[model samples]
Structures are given as C-alpha cells and as structure tokens.
Target: MNSCPFQRARSPEQKAERRAQILEAAALFFAEQRFAAISLAAIARQSGVTKAALYRYFPSKEALFLALYLSELDAMVEAPLPQEGPAWAAISELLIARPLFCRLTSILHTVLEHNLDESQAREFKQALLACFAQLAARLQRDFALEGDQAIRFLMQVQQSVIGCWAVSQPAPVVASVIKAPPLDVFQVEFGDALRTQLRALQAAL
Candidate 1:
C-alpha cells in the first residue's frame, strides 16, 4: 500500500514546533509587507500547511498575528533594559531595535483586536495584561515610580510608539515627497522622537 504523505503533529512538542513554524512564516511576511497586505493563503503556502490546518492552529488571521505579537511581548518582558542613571535612553533603544514589535503594537487596537472572537480576545488581553504588569513592575523598581505611575508611564509610552511609528511610515509616494528640502521638516525620526517623548514623560512623572 502507498503511504499517506501528510504529516500530523500528534505530540505536544510536535504541535508546538508546528505552531512556531507558522509564526515564523507570518513574521517573514510581516517584515516584507504591510499588515493589511498579508493573507492566510500566502502564509499557509509559506508554512507548507493547508489553509484548513492553519485554522486548526489559529481561528483567524487576527488570532495568528495576535499570538505572534504576544510572543514578542513575552520576549520584551524577558529582555533586560539597563537600570542605570536614566531609564528613558535604555527604553528608547530597546524599542528602536525592535521595529516589528513596534509596528504590531501600533495596530493592536485598530486592526488585530477587531476581528477576534470573545475567547480569542480574552486570551489576547489576558496575556497582554500579564506582560504589561511584569514590565510595569520593572519600570517601578527602576524609575522609583508608584504602581499607578508605572502603569501611566507605560500607557503613555504605548501611545508614543503608536503615534510616532505611524507618522514615520507614510505611504510610498508621501515618503519620497517628505525627503525634499521644504518637506523634510515633516519627517519624523522614530528613535529620536520616541526618546524625546519618553524623556519628557519621565521628567513629568
């Protein structure tokens, strides 16, 4: 008898490996294209999985990207920021180094959260809160902030990243236009603007 060709992940470890492979494929697509431009069929092809198999791992495109974003958040929480004389510099540098994370975060509210079902939404938010709480605790310890202050600081930083990233990444034509002498003033340098905003927020708090 001819052997069946499709491979199935029966063990938990195999399932996790399959999930990671899918996430990796999604990440590559995200790096090269805008969020709105990516599709499940493309991702399925890249990951060597049928669209049906992809749905078994993730209910929707939103759910899959949300899972990837959550993994990024977990990595950020685990990464160490400098606990030196000033916190803003370290934080700014960290964000600058992670452009994909910043981009995903920029769309967290506007896109990724919209199509999610209740269970998916709850799971994402709960994981998000856990990441936030851990990061806030570190901020409080490093910056001598009260609990509320730390939370507020993070909220402000989130807003700053979202706003700054959006402005810095204009449409292709607009991006070219902005590089001209007269329009150069409108161009926003993500790292510089973010550092300035973070420094101001730290000073205010």
Candidate 2:
C-alpha cells in the first residue's frame, strides 16, 4: 500500500503551507540538480505529496519552477541594494549570491516558459515586466539613467546574466576540459564576468 504523508490540504492557511512546502522542496532540488534532471515525481516525493496532489498547487514541473523563480525574483526586488556601490555592482552581487536564481534565469525563456499554457505564460510575462519596471525606476533614481535608457540598461543586465551563466556552467565534459591549462582560459567566473559586463553596460549608458 502507498503511504500518504501529505493529506489534501483543506483550509486556505493549510493550502498556503502546503504550497510553501512544495516550493521549498523544489528550491532545494534545483540547488542540487540541473533543471532538466528534475521531475515532478521527484519533487512530489521530496515534498511528501503524491504526484497527483502536487498538481493541486502547481500544474506542471515548469509551473513549479516558474513559481519558485518568481518568488526568488520578488524577494530580490523587495530587498534594497547597497547604497555605497554602483547599481550594476550591487545588482551583480545580488544575482551571483543566489545560485538557484541565476540558474533558473539562465534557463527561463528556454525551459521554464516552454511548457506553460498561454494564460500562465502571459501571467509570467506580466510579473516579469512589473519587476523590470521597478528595477528601471531604481536605475533612473539611483544611477541617473533616463527613462528608455534605464529600461535598456536593465535589458543589458539580464542579457549579461544569462550569457555569463551559460558560459560559466558548461556540460560536465566541457567543464572537465576547461580545468586544463589552455582550456582553462575558457572558464568563466560568474561574479567577475557578470560584474565586468554590468560595468561595461553602465559605461555605455
């Protein structure tokens, strides 16, 4: 017989707690494994819910990941950046410290958004645009970037993070090869590379 560790959550509070549990489990799984390597079944097991029950909160693995990604982004947006540093530097530091956020960001458009239905996809875009607007406001106020320029700077930052993250985390075979002398030149330090890109983008702005 199958064990039922997570019952059907009934109350609104219970549902909220169950959702948090699922997201926490998903976040931990993402931290230790590549996104492609994880499954809804695995996340359900980790969260102590059946795969069927998991759907009560998240429609799909992509949805689950998207939710976690959005939560991470929301937290980042809510936190204030350091006052002493350049905005780009502070932004780079914030992103680099959150490995799961960086990893998810790298695969966002490629993987996370791939399986979403139209409504889910639209919601995700809306949320992201809101975040960008908030960030653009920060750039205008703190960094003296004008309206469109602030938006452009934010776009450049996202591009740099995605590009740098991809280069920094290659396939296992490529990673091993990069450990050797000449190939070592190809290795990317995420923070340094991202910061450099951000600095260059700011200079151009």
Candidate 3:
C-alpha cells in the first residue's frame, strides 16, 4: 500500500499544485546551483514535501530536470512574438530574463541530457523535438523561410545561446576579467550574440 506524506491530495487541483510546488522548488535550486550537485532530497526539503511524496511527483532527479525544461518551453510558447526583429530579440530577452535557463542549455548536451534509460531519453528527446519544431514553424512565419531554413535558423540560435553562455559564465577570475575595463569588451552577451547570428543568417539567406 502507498503511504501519503503530510496530507493526502483531496482533489485534482491539489495534486497539480503539489506537483507545481515540487517543480518550482527544483527550478529555483537548479538556477542557483549546478545540475549534478542538486539532490532529490534537497528538492523534497525545499518543496516542503517528504522524500516519498517527491518521488510520487518525479521518479528521479533527471525526471524533475526534464519537467523544469518543459516548463521553460511552455513559457516560450506562451509569449506573443511580434515579427519585427523578433526572433533574436525575443530569445535574447528570454535568456536575459531567465539567465538560469541559459545555464541549463549549456549543461543539457553534456550533463542532464545523459544518464537516462532509452525509454526516458526517447521521451525527453521527443518533447525537445516538439519544442524545436514549434519554434521553427513560428520562425517560418516570421522570416518567410522554407522548412529547412527555419530549422537551421533555430539550430544557429541554440548554438549561439549555448556558446555565449559558456563564454559569459566563466570562473571567478575570468568572470572578473570579463566584467572589468578593457577585458569587458570581450564579454559575450548571449542576447547580443543571438541577435548577431540572426542578422547574419538573414543576410546570408
């Protein structure tokens, strides 16, 4: 028999709220900490739920991370994108507003994207593809681009964001250098880099 922790969920809304609470806690932790360094127990504590109850919402830490990523995508989907200089501007604005989201992208390929079973990985990949596809389709409308062009544009956007994130998020010493005079010129802003790439792509196309 399953044991309920704290209190049993009496309604579907309660269940959903509980799940959202866990996800919110996890996302806040990920924003402030490294992906590999965060633990499910920590998330349970932060969410004010028992470890057993946290497991009821997310089977593992990676699953929780996946949920966080999905929430990020949902935010992007909800935004009303205007056509004028929108792609880069919109994405850059998003990264600026949620810098932790950019950090997650930097780790996605190397860390959080791995260490999963085939089935789970497939599920995550499908959701990722869907997000990319939706973004690309919207780009098609905005740029009046072909299907392939839309996808390629999105790929470039991801690469720019990831690369800029890596460059901008340096160690203590490097970060200091990046923020100082002279060296500050070398600081890479993800938003600017993304906008530059889009402009270049527009010129090329």
Best by TM-score: 1
Model 3 bad stretches (over 4 Å): 1-5, 178-185
Tens-place lDDT digits, model 1, residues 57-167: 998999999999998888888888887867678778888989989999899999999987788788788888888899889878877778988888888999999999998
Residue range 22-134, candidate 3, lDDT tens digits: 88888888777878789998888777788898888777887788778778876775666766764556556755676756777777778777768899899998988888898
Positional deviation of residue 109's Cα in model 3 after best superposition, in angstroms: 1.1
Q: Against the unseen true structure, what C-alpha lDDT does each candidate score?
A: 0.86, 0.86, 0.75
Each prediction's RMSD over C-alphas, in Å, is 3.3, 2.5, 3.7
lDDT of 3: 0.75
Better of 2 and 3 by TM-score: 2
**After superposition, which runs of candidate 1 have C-alpha atoms over 4 Å from their true positions?**
1-6
lDDT (C-alpha) at residue 74 in model 2? 87
- 1-205 per-residue lDDT for model 2 (tens digits): 1235768889999889888888998898888888889898988888878899999789988999999999898888887877777878888888888888888989888998998889999999999989889878887787777989888888888888899999988889999989989889999989999999998998898
Error of 2 at 65 (Å): 0.6
User: Sort by TM-score, best first: what order?
Assistant: 1, 2, 3
Model 3, residue 90: what's the lDDT?
A: 58
Residue pairs with colliding backbones in model 1 are: none
Error of 2 at 158 (Å): 1.2
